[model samples]
Target: MPWWSWILIWVALVALSLLLYVFLGIRLFRQFMATLKDLGAAGKKMGHISPLEQAQTRPEAGRPLPGSAVFASPTVMRHDYEASKSSRREQRRLKRVQRKTDRGQPQALGDLDFT
Candidate 1:
């Protein structure tokens, strides 16, 4: 083939590839938009129902429904809170002691002489 013919063929192939790319991109964008619309509709439907109503409708095997207390009694909850508070206080005290000990120790690597 002549040089000009070869150039023309190359140009036609590039244009065809560009058109194919744009067509596929538009098709994918439409599909994504449709999916987004479906998700929005589903979200709106979910929003219309109250959480309590939804919880009451669904049956869970092992778990309690929405607002029922997990603990047996108020005293149990209070005892749990008090235990957690004491544990946290002890952790803070230990960390304070650790920090003081760490500050008193020398951390310099220069003190060791390498011959």
Candidate 2:
């Protein structure tokens, strides 16, 4: 092939590369915006569920909220308070269990706790 032919091929390759770059850049920008919109929607959903609403439905299922019915004086709703307390106690128990497991279950030293 002539030198001019090789130069023309090089020019075509460079143009193709630039076109691909621009196409990919625009595609990625649109994808990023879509992801951000989804994240915003997720945040809005979380915000829609206030502590009061959560407590009214299933207080025991979530972390206790400050000044919730669970913690009110005399505990008008004993079941709610008990449920919250049980959840908290279960969390603490799970933490202790995890600690024991992570610590490799203590070695038995003459009747010491084996786990």
Candidate 3:
């Protein structure tokens, strides 16, 4: 109701708003720095697995090396694709032959060609 009270109320409101913004800004800055630190660490770990080094060595379970698709030649990719396809076909043929033998059924002529 008094004139001075109106000025005091506005001053308190402005000070509280400024404090909230400063706290929020500080929190945001800390989070951003943490994110950058994590990103750098991950980059260093992944850098240890260079494309060339992985390509020269084989991984377990016929697993392709990481980033091979992005860095490998087209011919290399095609060879890998064909090899995987042929291996699958060979496995299927073997399973079919075994199943037929177990059942006392005749085998197909294609199954006999073990090429």
Candidate 4:
């Protein structure tokens, strides 16, 4: 009702909003720092763990798990071969289209200088 009372209410609201923002910003920064620390430790631990994993297994494990290779070989040998040929054709078509597109576009700065 009073003008002073309204001014006080406005001041209180602004203070509260600023406090909330500062609190949230500090909390978020702390969380981000904590996540970075955790990720660093995890990366370090993974490096150690990966070497331990490799050492724990026999060297032959890298070759094959018995007859599993017989089944896997045909899939690898045939599956991608036809797909690779098709992809080669596709790449040639894409290169032709790209050459045409490049002819129409302005050259970049890097293209003008080589060193």
- Root-mean-square deviation per candidate: 15.6, 11.4, 6.2, 18.3
lDDT of each: 0.77, 0.77, 0.92, 0.75
> Which is superior by TM-score, 2 or 4?
4
Q: Runs in model 2 with CA error above 4 Å?
A: 50-115
Q: Rank candidates, lDDT, best first.
A: 3, 2, 1, 4
lDDT of 3 by residue, 1-115 (tens): 9999999999999999999999999999999999999999999989889878867776887787677698989998999999999999999999999999999999999999755
Better of 2 and 3 by TM-score: 3
TM-score, per-candidate, Cα-based: 0.46, 0.43, 0.55, 0.44
Q: What is candidate 4's local distance difference test score?
A: 0.75
For residues 1-115, write the lDDT of model 1, one tens digit per residue. 7899999999999999999999999999999999999999999988888877776686667444555566468886677678879888868766766675678964334333255
lDDT tens per residue, model 4, 32-93:
99999999999988776675676667656324444554677677747656677877886876
**Position 99, candidate 3: lDDT:** 99
How many clashing pairs in candidate 3? 0
Which regions in candidate 3 have their CA more than 4 angstroms from the true location? Answer: 51-87, 96-115
Error of 2 at 64 (Å): 9.5
TM-score of 4: 0.44
Best by TM-score: 3
lDDT for position 21 in model 4: 100
